[model samples]
Target: MAEEKSNKKTNIGEVVSDKMDKTVVVAVERKTQHSLYKRVIKRTSKFKAHDENNECNEGDIVKIVETRPISKQKSWKVEEIIRKAK
Candidate 1:
């Protein structure tokens, strides 16, 4: 049989903090239109993701995937480092 792929939730965001041991904070931004005014607005959500190798750095672009909870606030893990910090 062919191998199966898991349908996990994923998000691409920028690393806002890499101060924690084996973890990093990523800020995901999305744009949505206001319900009443129809005005576009930018919204940001921060997620604490596991960086097992501690390779991610602040300001780096990364892709994270949802997984079993690792902590109170960390249910996501770094899937890949999209771009390194300059």
Candidate 2:
């Protein structure tokens, strides 16, 4: 039987930096319970995403999809802008 390929992974986060050309850093924050302490903790992970048109700005909420590596540190691409920054 042939298996269907699933779509690439995607993440939603707020854009933290847009100083690089065609690239932006997105910070995704999540809350998780400590493994043993049973306490809730907040964690943040940053990812570099490619923006073809350089449309992303700092503080914008964006969706990013995993893609083939476009650079040394970029394996994600900007999929859409979920919300505009105030």
Whole-model lDDT values for every prediction: 0.98, 0.97
Model 2, span 4-67: residue lDDT tens:
8868998999999999999999999999999999999999999999999999999999999999
Q: Which pairs, if any, clash in model 1?
A: none
- Where is model 2 more than 4 Å wrong at Cα? 1-5
Shift of residue 1 alpha carbon in model 1, Å = 12
Q: Local error of candidate 1 at 5, Å?
A: 4.3
- Tens digits of lDDT, candidate 1, 1-86: 99889799999999999999999999999999999999999999999999999999999999999999999999999999999999
TM-score of each: 0.93, 0.90
Candidate No. with top TM-score: 1
Candidate 1: residue 48 lDDT (0-100): 100
Best by lDDT: 1
**Local distance difference test, candidate 1:** 0.98
